[model samples]
Target: MSLVPDILLTGAGAFILVSLVIVFRVVRGPTMQDRVIAVNAIGTNIVVVLALVAAATGNRAALDIAIVYALLNFLMSIAISKFTVERGGVL
Candidate 1:
């Protein structure tokens, strides 16, 4: 109906597509660091998607959940890096 909704939906779709491509990179990465980076990129895309959904649906709760998810993603990345370092660069 409205152009704004169509635009947001398109953006969400694009984000999903990008995330899928990143997933492929994660699965086929030659190195652990590359996989970790791909995973992080996926997480970022997920956050953007969540925000888009929240805006499209006018749901404040979704925004809050997205914030929490983002924090968790950041912590996970840090933990992965620490683990890799402790394991002598082998993940």
Candidate 2:
């Protein structure tokens, strides 16, 4: 029998659904900044999903991976933002 909590499953499912909605923004954003923000949101959602999975499965290793992924996501957003801001000195 599985011991995973329902709340964790629900949270993960919700985040996945939100991420799917964000995909439309990533594909159809009116500006580069908007697309970048959507990508960042998707990355953040993935991190949350990882954390929820770790909590449900009692896998401490997944939590460590989530931390690393979060750091990379933050760095990626900053780098993309800088790139967009400096393209011809404006995006």
Candidate 3:
């Protein structure tokens, strides 16, 4: 029963809670850009959670997945922005 694991779990839980709030914003966003930003934030939170889990479990694979996920999230944000611009602000 180490305190380190408990702290890591708490951190992950906090990240998840914040991500959930971001999800609500994404769902209820008044504009497309707002939703996009919220989605990006959620992705970031998820990445942090993955990193924490990797640290807690000493699993390198989780960190690798987090890296790949972060790349995909970045690409998706760019694509969404481009699409928004091309479509004249329609999501």
Model 1, residue 53: C-alpha shift (Å): 0.8
Using TM-score, give the best candidate's number: 3
Evaluated with lDDT, which candidate comes out highest?
3
Instruction: State in Å the error of residue 80, model 1.
Output: 0.4
Question: Which consecutive 10 residues in model 1 have the weakest lDDT in total?
Answer: 1-10
Q: Rank the candidates by TM-score, best first.
A: 3, 1, 2
Cα RMSD, model 1: 1.7
lDDT of each: 0.91, 0.91, 0.94
Q: Determine the backbone clash count of candidate 1.
A: 0
Q: Which sections of candidate 1 miss by over 4 Å?
A: none
Model 2: lDDT of residue 34: 86
Candidate 3 overall lDDT versus native: 0.94
Tell me which of candidates 1 and 2 scores higher on TM-score: 1
Question: Residue 41 of candidate 3: its Cα lDDT?
Answer: 97
Candidate 1 lDDT by residue in tens digits, 1-91: 5678678878999999999988988999998899999999999999999899898888999899999999999999999999999989974
Tens-digit lDDT track for model 2 on 1-91? Answer: 4656578979999999999999999999988888988999999999999999899988999999999999999999899888877885353
Q: How close is candidate 2 to the true structure, as a TM-score?
A: 0.89
Better candidate number, 1 or 3, judged by TM-score: 3
Candidate 1 achieves a global lDDT of: 0.91
Per-prediction TM-score, please? 0.92, 0.89, 0.94
